[model samples]
Target chain A: MLDKALSGSSRYWTWVIALMAIIGIGFVFWVQQMIEGLTITGLSRDVTWGLYIAQLTFFVGVAASAVMVVLPYYLHDYKEFGKLTILGEFLAIPAVIMCMAFVFVDMGQPIRIVNVFLHPSPTSPMFWDTVALFGYLVLNVVIAYVTFGAEKKGIAPPKWIKPIIILSIPWAVSIHTVTAFLYSGLPGRGFWLTAIMAPRFLASAFAGGPAILILLVLLVRKLTKFDPGLKPIFKLAEIVTYAMLVNVFFVLMEIFTVFYSQIPGHMDHFTFLYVGLDGNTTLVPWMWTSTILAAVALFLLLVPKLRRNEKVLPVACGSVIVSIWIDKGLGLMTGGFVPTPTHHVVSYVPTLPEIMITLMVYGVGALILTVLYKIAITEREIIEQVK
Target chain B: MAKSTRRGFLKLAGVAAVGMGAKPVYDAFARRSAPEQPTPPAEALTAKRWAMVVDTRKCLREHGCTDCITTCHLVHNVPDFGNPKDEVKWVWKEQFEHGFPEQHNEFMSDDLRHKDVLLLCNHCDNPPCVRVCPTQATWKREADGIVMMDMHRCIGCRYCMAACPYGSRSFNWRDPRTHIAKIDEGFPTRTRGVVEKCNFCAERLVRGEIPACVEACKAKALAFGDLEDPESEVRDLLSRHFNIRRKPGLGTQPEVYYIV
Candidate 1:
């Protein structure tokens, strides 16, 4: 089965070699990070967390997005998603793995990650986040393996696995919710202290995550002979639309509250991001670009004619992903730190080493996903042959 | 058993009698309803929740109090960056305007030009860092109410660093071992990419020693003591002089008090 799948790609080795080279480059950068410390990163006291954490935040959403297709197909009995759901599940395995890796690289001591379990503090949101992330990873991997094994046998998945599938729908939501709690629970950073943070995170995750997945499905269809039906893709796009609307609404609500009360604590962060505060104007362009992209993406997605068009659909999805990446990933983390308690502006830029390590982490995730997808595709081909 | 030592036997009997007599009294106190007596004055308590009072008014920015920062960093094995970008400061001096933006008034002195005040972790009564830390790596000690970071448990997500409004937390983006070769071998160097900050010298506190910064203060501008104890030196200082906390409007209720 594996050999059959390998035969389908004449240039498979070339792709593998290229991925290996990228991974190797990333390894050298990791060594640099270990030796030089985070000083090699653009982070400073003002922006203590930068690209690594931002990417982690973004990918957690991607992992959760797997549920958009998984729930409808597995639980709702949406047969249109039958062929595509496996891809989503397989994609989640590597996405979650990357989520964990991003977090690992962000840590000062990755080995001490075990201390979270050893001496757990239930009261801390960080503890709950760890629990949720690890739990979700376990669930996704277990469910994927079980489903794949059943598929290889040309049989319905075991009765016991149905409950796991149902449980995963909520678990997917929990992972992103807990990740948001890691931010919103903070008391001093007024920007992150909002009650709506967790919900907004979920909304944004549902939006950007599914959009990326839709784009991925198109890529898979183009590259591979496997054709997941267009109906499921359309439905997923609809889900992305609603999620994006909620995300945009929640952001507007934040803006309204900030402007309505005119409270310095709430308004200061917005001022720093959109308008310069104390003459510091670094994030203004980024914020404006995100705002405009979000608007354009929403406009394109809301129109049925535009959203249905293949060319327009990918563009809309890509725009939303980039917009949310900026809004939640870069803007959210950095904006929260601006106008520091001292009302001083401190900037964070990802240094070359930090960027390289980030690229390496991404490559690692892609490599894992590529291997997993290859195996699943081979197994499907074997089942087809047996039939 | 050999000689039936009378002194030893008597001592045991005396201890048993004291234990027996004290049992009912202890039980009675435990079983009794709440006392009707008024609460004791805040100052009379001995086990004071520790706090720091920074006299920003006396902060010269001529680098007078910088010795405190340097000594504390040296003692804690905090990394020294020859460049500002790489600097991971547990304590440092910030210009007066940067330190007290909300407190700016026209009446303030021109002599205060370029005046800087020593800044470190505020160790808030309701620290966001403590609340956000997922691994329980950062915690507020119940004994003295000081916010501390346990580096061993920290996953270095920088959540606490991002959560802190004061910018007091620092991340060790690279191995801090290189910079700490001169420090005492007892203090451990931090790994790359973990968040670290002033722990109030928790080790020194256990040894009944003052934080290195307090001991090194040239102008006697920094004070540390139990805030919960009304009679503690910090409380006394607070009462004797007007003081402000960094970002009080945020309502973190910082234990670090600055007198201007």
Candidate 2:
């Protein structure tokens, strides 16, 4: 089936080459980061995490979103998703790859990363996250490959694959929940300590991940003959709208609790994000932009007439992806550190090397995504022709 | 390759369940009672919960008095990067308003408002850092409550940094060796991408000496002793003065105490 991908037009080769070029540039910077240390990034002692972690958080959502398609198709026996389930699973392959890569890049001692497994502490959320991510990656890879292989052979998927598919639904929820647990369980960080963090992570993930899926399916329709159709796409749009609504509601609840209670420790972080905190307002503009974008996205998605319009659907989905990316990827961890542990306001901005390295990680994800997607589409084309 | 039978799956699950319970059951039998008096000549291991007392009056907010801080940094080979963003401090000075955040008040005495306080790792009994450490790279010593860091084992994820409420831990963003003008042979300089913090002078303690800071304080403001010993100076000092530990209400049970 991959042989079909090998014999692509110059256009496909060009895209692959472009991703490779970006990856090469990223590799050079990565080497520099490893040698010069994370200091090359804009990260400070006060804000220990910066660009790499944000990317990790964002991709984890993307990876977990695979279950949205898988659940409806396998559990509910929704035939519309049969053609598109492989797309979600394949997209997850690269997303999980990116998730793991971002984690590696963020490490202070990348070499000692194995210590998490070798000297495993069941108590640490990081350890559990390591488990959740790697496990999810393995599950997706197996399910996608086996199902596609069966499709390529023009046979029914093996009966045993059903259990693994069933397991992935809860596994998907666990991945995001565990990622949320990473932040929410921390004792003193004012911004991330709330109980709603895990639920909020899932809500945004359900919207953001599926939003990417809708966009990817559109890309697939244009790039290949495998059109998942307007029916499946419209159904996905509905999921995105409802999930984003819940996500927005959760954010409002957080705002009410933080502001109404007026706890200085908690209020100070929100102040830094929305208003300036002690004259340090680096993230103020970005926060407001996300808020506006989220509102516009919910407005566009909630209106059924606007949602059905092909032109408006992409716009709504793109807004959701951007909005959550800013919320989870950029502001979530960094905002929590404001009025630092000592109650001093400090700021962080990613440096050029950090941004380059971050882009390289995305390029790697794109490369993996393009290859995996090409194979899935090629298999779909061959299977349809035989039928 | 037979299909996995329900009986076989259940058997595997049963074994895994028993394996998980084995550790706790063994520990229950193996656990030792708290010693009334610390075992003497236990230099190779830790003590019965180390604690400290900071006498703020004797700490002396005098001009340019960094006897404790300077001694700690110099001995530990802690680098001074001169940039706050890249700064790596093992132990440092902070204002009362900043260090004791919950205790801040606008109508407080002018002197207290301007007061300088020494801050370092609390060595909490229920350390959030330890609980959050993915690799157990940082842990509380079972013998003493001193939070220990296995620098070689640390992945530098900095989750522990986020978990700590005191801003105590510092990460080595660059090769820490780059910032040091001179080397201290007694202490091993840390590599880049590892978190470092005050260890209650765990190294010096093993040598049967007090913390470098306590010994170097000209004002004799620092006190270090075993909390388990009723006659120890730290315990005696705590009994004599009404001292406050940072974020006591968090229930971390910090071992460090300060007297105003």
- The candidate maximizing lDDT is 2
Q: Quote the lDDT for B142 in model 2.
A: 85
Q: After superposition, how far is residue A30 of candidate 2 from its true place, in Å?
A: 0.7
How do the residues B1-260 of candidate 2 rate in per-residue lDDT, one tens digit apiece?
11122333343444577656645643453344323676566655356989989998778886858889888998898998999887888778888899998898999887877788889999999999999999888989888889999897899999999899999999998998878878899999999999999999988887778899999989999998989999899999999998999988778889999988
Q: What is candidate 1's lDDT per residue for A1-387, written digit by digit as tens?
A: 245435546466677667878889988988877666666778776777778888878888889988988988877888998877888887887888888888888776676676666556677776787788888889988888888888877888889988898999999999888888877877657788889998998899999988987998888777766667688888888998999999999999999998899977779899999997878888899999999999999999999999998899999999899999999988998888776767777787777888888888889888877777777766765667533
lDDT of 1 by residue, B76-116 (tens): 88877676666788888877777766667678786553577
**Model 2 ranges with Cα > 4 A deviation:** B1-46
For all predictions in the order shown, the interface RMSD in Å is: 10.2, 7.4
- Most accurate candidate by TM-score: 2
Indicate the TM-score of model 1. 0.86
Query: Model 1 chain B — which ten-residue stretch has the worst lDDT?
Result: B1-10
lDDT of 1: 0.79
The C-alpha RMSD of each candidate to the native structure, in angstroms, is: 9.8, 6.3
| Candidate 1 chain A: 10-residue stretch with minimal lDDT | A1-10
